[model samples]
Target: MSRHLNAGERIIESETLSGGITAEMRKLTIWTTDGFSRNLVLRTYTDSASLQHAEDSLERESTALTTLSGSAVPVPELLAFDSTATHCEYPSILMTHVPGSTVLADEGVDDRVPLLARQLVEIHAVKAEPRPREYQAMTTADTVVVPTRADAEVWAAAIDVLRGPVPTYDGRVLHRDFLPGNVLFDVSQNAAPSITGVVDWAGASWGPTDLDVAHCSTNLALLHGPQWGPRFASAYEEAGGVLSESTRTRQYWRVRDALACSEEVQSWAAPWREAGRVDLTPGVVEDRLDAYISMLMNASGQ
Candidate 1:
């Protein structure tokens, strides 16, 4: 911390920031020689499993921040990183604090959806040279967790979709985890709401744009409603973002990502519950996922 600080600057305060499940996030307030304070975000992988299993996560985030600097995407500026924990107690990356807060409330979602869609379009437009690692699937058909009350036939069909070969796609820069939680919004009273920044770049990758869309759509379904899942896909298209040409191919990706969240809906709801969305219990999320899967199947003419 001292090495990155400007001369005569000292840390004035530190506070934990929420919405991070895999890492510890801290906002460091620094008092500079000019008698003003600035903020920086420190993300630390304190969990032993993260350090042991995903050893290159911090390195990937650092590289991503470096790559996206000055691009249209609003991402934090990387200040420093210690991927091996040689200089810090845990593997950490320090970055300039991006302004705004995550908007998880159910109210005003209709207004915010299009902005989220547009910003994601801008993110995919970026051409990453020496791109980040290729995207990896988080769940397989065998690994999918079927909800107890889910329609057994529908769930079976969804799982079978994943068992088929992956569809062909043109690679694009992907914000591999571009869900609402990772997006920050500026919603001032007098002005329209807009996306201020997108954080959590550790999962950034080079992949099909549909994969990124699927991830966010699945999250929207769980966080808001089943209608919102398909609504977001429509919003994305209206925002000038193109999806896979075939409806079946799009359904395959959407079903795959939706099923991936089945096992972790309860864990995912914990943070949102803490953030004041107590209505989003695990059961509610599961029901939404089931509805979302059924919608995709029907849309694909199953």
Candidate 2:
């Protein structure tokens, strides 16, 4: 609705809907020189208070892209960036569309499960700068050092332990969100495609190699169920991955994910509450919530 937008660039057609973080992701039918031929997905964020932080994330992504430039990885090409404004009123980025049939079968992630593990191993195989840690406001180092002993808080606790020992460990390149959905399987490459692009650089950070694997493995199980769980780990081990070293780190993320799910229940709360959007049973939420809690308990050696 802002008048100061780029000239003659009225949105041909657009739709607003929930995106990855409860924010609106808009699909724009734009007027291109060749005609309205492009379908672009634009995700926006609010909280002007964190504009600077958003820009930093944008910059961090830029660095990751640059690091991944000459590799086999597939990622959306960064098109436009304006990290300084609020959603619909601030900075944004335009990316090339990544189109392909999802590898996820109706039953869930298929047995070609090892593909994910292979990619993770391959990503770490990439040589790049040390990964930066995400501390919400005051980011930390990637080298993890568990000091005197581990704490009970899980993810944050691991960071505390690692901070005392080695805040930043020079490790393999980590795709912070290297999940199956984040992965694009190439059907065009005669079995495996020549390129597999990983999207969503929001949480891309450098750290332990196994952290990436465990994040994907545990999350897949959490999202899809136990069937795909062991296969993921199986594929990971087959791909030269080490489970022992990062299991603790992986546990941290598993617990962190549960906390994330809990927060979402509160998101869109006021509107949903007024709209009677609490259709999902409370027990269902608790069941899913408990999965993460169980994972945390197991990781704590409790």
Candidate 3:
């Protein structure tokens, strides 16, 4: 349609769509004079501004993508990153438009399932000494998100669990947002999405591979629910993953992480609560807590 230039150098056009509340994913088709069609996506961060630390988020995203470029992950090449934290420029990251339908929204993506597992595993295999302290140093990424924050033990235990010497992840990049939307596929081609490439390395970190899996699990659950989560976990384990007790802790990390962002949960769920609707926000935190507790219990059992 109409071409508009965002920033000074890039001339881009984006349109909004219905469905999902995280950010606005605009269908961006970049223009080239040579009749070359390049379709890229631009995500304008629209998380509830009241609860959002926009500047910090953009900083994380920029760093994570930069690190991801050198890691094992297959991320879309970065086109531009502008973190206008103070200038109020709406921190944005313009990414290379990789071509693939979403595994969560679109159907007929069964075959590419294995590669999803493979990609996570391969990307996680990269090692970094002394894992970074927090994921935000990573990226405004898609870490396994839990929509609540009303827990205490989860926070303490996560520190205890991850306190050990960071596993050697080969310094490869972690795709903090290794979910379906960030993933591109060639479902039309028999070869699965080909993974074509990955998007949102903003939260890429030097942590256990399980962090990647848990992140995938949590995000996929938001879109596809439990069915997708377990299926993805199973596929990951089946594909020759070098599983260990430590890696399993990533699930606990996910719980702790989700708890940390409880405010967001309160935001999305607050409306329902004010209207005297059955409050699910408490349950959201509870579910995450139970998962964390279960992880602890299982470890004791072992």
Candidate 4:
């Protein structure tokens, strides 16, 4: 901590940041020699389980921040990282804080949806030399957790989509977890709401752009409504982001990502529940997921 701090600068405060499930996040306020305060965010993987992959996760995030440093994307500046936990209590990363709060309320999603779409376009457009690791699937057909009351036929169809071989795609940089919770927004009386920064790059990868879009779409479906899932895809196209030429191929990615969420729906809802969305019970999320899959299949004429 002392090495990362400027001469005569000292920590004045530390506050825990919520809405993250994987890592413990803290905001550190530093009082500098110039008599002003600045903030840095610390992300530490402290759990016994998380420790198993902490080094890899921290390495990915640090490399991502380094890769996107001069790009149009609004990302926090990486200050320091201890991927091995040798210099810190746990594997950690310290980065300059981006100003904004996550907006999870459903009322203004329509306004932010396009901005989210455009930001994703910018993110996917970045080129990385010796690209990040290939994206990995989080769920397989056998691993999918079907909702207790889900339409068996619909779920079977959705799961079947994943049983097929992974689709081939031109690789692009991916914010593998590009959901609303990872996006920061600034909403003020004086101006329109806008995205301020995107955080959580530990899952960054190189993959089909649709995978990133699918991840965010599934999250939007659970957070807002099933309609928002497909709505985001349309918004992405309007914002100049391209999807696969075949509807079947596009549906495969969408269904695959949506099913991945089913397996961890309960755990995923925990952070949103903590953030004041008590209405998003596990049961509700499961139902929304079912609806989103049905909608996808219907649109694809499956």
Best by lDDT: 4
User: Could you give candidate 2's per-residue lDDT for residues 113-194 as a string of tens digits?
Assistant: 7667777777777776555554231224243322223332544543443344322334567777676556666666445443
Clashes in each model (backbone N, CA, C under 3 Å)?
Answer: 0, 10, 18, 0
State candidate 1's TM-score.
0.97
TM-score against native, each model: 0.97, 0.64, 0.61, 0.97
- In the range 39-122, model 3's lDDT, one tens digit per residue, is 666666756651265445555566655555666666666666556633334556666666554454424435656788888877
The segments of candidate 1 whose C-alpha lies over 4 angstroms from its true place after superposition are: none
Worst 10 residues of 2 by lDDT: 143-152
Model 3 TM-score (2 dp): 0.61
Full ranking by lDDT = 4, 1, 2, 3
Q: What residue pairs are clashing in model 4?
A: none
Residue-level lDDT for 143 in candidate 2: 34
Model 4, range 181-228, lDDT digits (tens) per residue?
999998888789988899999998999998899999999999999988
Instruction: List residue ranges in candidate 2 displaced over 4 A.
Output: 1-11, 47-52, 86-88, 101-108, 129-170, 184-196, 242-282, 285-302
Question: What is the lDDT, from 0 to 100, of the residue 3 in candidate 2?
Answer: 42
Between candidates 3 and 4, name the one with more favorable TM-score.
4
Model 1: per-residue lDDT, tens digit, 4-104?
Answer: 99999999999999878889999999998988999999999887667773457877788889999999999999999998889988889999999999999
